[model samples]
Target: MQATQPLVGKETAFITGGASGIGRATVLRLAEDGFRVVVIDRNALQVEALVAELVQAGYDAVGHAVDVCDRSKISALIDAEARVDVMVCAAGIGPSCAFDAISDEDFRAVLEVNVLGVFIASQEAVRRMKPGGRVVTVSSRAALGGGGFAHYVASKAAVVGLTRAMAMDLRQRRIAVNSIAPGFTDTGMTRAMTPAQHAAASALEPAGRPAEPHEIANAIAFLASPRTSFITGQTIFVDGGKSLGGLGL
Candidate 1:
């Protein structure tokens, strides 16, 4: 954990998994929106690349290579920050496996990354935050109920529940907590799917295509903005109507 550039008058946003996928998109979007962004990711090279890109683009940004599940390290990182105006929990893992065949180790791994990771990061960031701070979590539409990834679905469902509880607890402090549930999005995670699986997912989308990472980032940016002070404890679905569930007429 290297020392970040000084945070001037600008608000600071600390984001986990900000090296790629929706997390990377959010980092870019928030930086463009004028926040001094702090990116945390497990990949040191990716973190360096992103931070360099941001600095070259004239954005105040820094990157840290740390796993979100490392609670003590995450807490220390957040503690070192002058102020964390926003925290986005976007680190998660979703491996497809049949429920009957899912190993205990596999299921626990998903929960640790998806559920425990969010809890640790959010708790740490909020401790250093002021009133009106924001926390945006990334969940998935699979939480609504899906097949082949029981572990993922369960973890995301827990995130939604945690968001609601956090909102209630933090309401008096004027901090807003919300979540975004993205459908099949064009991310590295989704790109790892088999070709047939990818095609089937796209075909099932009512929008006839997977969401772009920026699309989900756009929604997250909105939730993290000052304008969303009134919106909390809600799950905004950026799933292109996949959650609507009625097949194409």
Candidate 2:
């Protein structure tokens, strides 16, 4: 939460999956930072409501209902925008399915949203980004290890690789690409876990609890800041020190 004023020339930011969780928190934060914000998500009603809240709060903001995997819609939205200085790809899902029970369709579905969805958004964002622009994507700590959810782990790991490659590809253009690999964050997705499951997971974190949505959003804002110009192609883990060991190190 830096001072609520324009930074790096009042740049405009586009965020995906902005209806809730980390995405929602980031939308409000960047707006506070004085960027003209555009929130894109597949949830139409939620998007509308969020935009209305931002508008009421006096932030230059708009909302669009979009499935990130739909390139046509994404292209149209980016094309309509005059400039994009920051992009945050926070749309993703992590479902827990035992490897033995996982199916092809289910696996692909996760990849479709978590992996391809991010790819589509990042590709489009890179195209519309101005020089010095920043792109922050969401990965997961599970990417660093073999987890129970193979599909989720694989897809998130792909994001880290994609982010690094994108950082290299976009360096010539002076646009930085980075990722935040959050650990055990308490969001809607985590809330879906049963109390017993949640307790068991929370016990594993060195911090002994899940992260607040705003906590992760704060890291995201920092990475999206022009101040982080020297930072690129790295995945900073915001996992309450969970990465220090929690699972089979």
Candidate 3:
């Protein structure tokens, strides 16, 4: 990881699903970069534990057990903050199911967390953000195209569209918006896959391995930084060439 210059002042970062996986990694990276990180997640115990750890490490941090889809609660938290310099919509769910096996409820659940959650958080955060603010949404390489988890793919694709529209809308405000489309990453979510499924994913990766959460965080941190002022409305693929095509399945 490249060293980041400590941000001066009390610049605050709000990250949803920040208790684990990519979200957790981003929280640590942002905090290390000198942002006062505010972690929001549904896992109360994990939220408290992570915040405690950051505090013990001498980093400015706090946490709340809040679902990203809860607009009122998310808005209230953001409203309470003095200022929100960065917002990372890392909260998402991707349950793999065959298209034929996907029930309406299953599909809705994925959209609720993966799409609506990001929309709600980004909306509230953008309202509170000022010029030069940053919003980074987590999309996925699957958003490009995939077989299993149709709902997950659709939700992520929506995120990409939403990100582009946000960047255009916020250009006048000078707030940059971007999305990172990570490939197969080693996280609790990926670990949930059956061993065979996991092995297949890893084999498909051009790097011959799954990405570490911190690797995805690295791209996110770059987009979240004020230095990326001119870059917006883009989907960066940190997929280790998996998205380059011709994997020969």
Candidate 4:
């Protein structure tokens, strides 16, 4: 790993949806960057393994299993954990189906996890963070457009809006809030697709490839760092330029 950045030392970051995928990558990135990391995820095994790995590596890391939709659990967790300098709300689900095909339960569930999850997590994080703290939420490039996945796109768009609003709301306290709008990437969720499906999805990228998990983690690290003090209320696209070309070409 590269030398840990100075802004990362002696600080703590709380992350949600951290058992696997982008959350796991962010946890490792933050740990490697010298921040004490606490992750909340629904996957007990994955969370436990990650925590153990970080411990063995001489880094401060712990994991909690909780549903992000539950406000009481979130409040209790934050109360127990006390203060954190950074919070990354990366817990979300993407159910891509046509608008009419989206069932009521599925639509609500997606909204709860993607939009309300960020709202609840950010609310708790703001309460626990110091004045110069940072909050980075994981939005999606779907926020910029609405197409095949109407429910997912709607929920993620709310994330972007919430991020911007929170940035304004938190600015007075010197706490920066931002969101990362990532394009397609190869994750466990995306692993369900056929090779042809994955290739076709990735082929839309102007950069000609899907992003690696580490790439997004690096962007989160940058946003969470004190060095990004001047940056806030923005959605940084780490999406390999896919958003630029909506065409299937």
Top candidate (lDDT): 1
For model 4, residues 157-182, the per-residue Cα lDDT tens digits are 99999999999999999999999988
The sequence of per-residue lDDT tens digits that candidate 3 reaches over residues 1-249 is 001223456898989999999999999999999888989999999998898888889898878899898899999888767788999999999988899999999999999999899889999998878899999999999889899889999999999999999999999999999999999999999999889989988988888899999999999999999888789999999989878888764
- Superior candidate under lDDT, 3 versus 4: 3
* lDDT per residue (tens digit) for residues 1-249 in model 1: 343475767899989999999999999999999998999999999999999888888898888899999988888777777778999999999999999999999999999999999999999888878899999999999889999999999999999999999999999999999999999998999999988989888888887789999999999999999888789999999988878868652
RMSD of each: 1.3, 3.8, 3.9, 4.0
Report residue 92 deviation for candidate 2 (angstroms): 0.6
Q: What order do you get sorting by TM-score, best first?
A: 1, 3, 2, 4
lDDT score, candidate 3, position 128: 79
Candidate 1 residue 190 Cα shift, in angstroms, is 0.9
TM-score of each: 0.97, 0.93, 0.95, 0.92
Name model 2 segments beyond 4 Å from true: 1-9, 246-249
Q: How well does candidate 1 match the true structure in TM-score terms?
A: 0.97
Write down the TM-score for model 3.
0.95
Candidate 4 weakest ten by summed lDDT = 1-10
Cα error of candidate 3 at position 192, Å: 0.7
Tell me the spans in candidate 4 whose CA falls farther than 4 Å from its real position: 1-9, 246-249
Task: Kindly indicate the candidate among 1 and 4 with the higher TM-score.
Answer: 1
Cα lDDT for residue 201, model 1? 85
Clashes of 2: 0
Residues 1-249 of candidate 2 have per-residue lDDT tens digits of 111233334587888999899999999898898778889999998898888888778888878899989999988887766677888999998899999899999999999999899899999888877789899999989998765799999999999999999999999899999999999988999999999999888888877788888899999999988899779999999998877774652
lDDT of all predictions: 0.92, 0.87, 0.91, 0.85
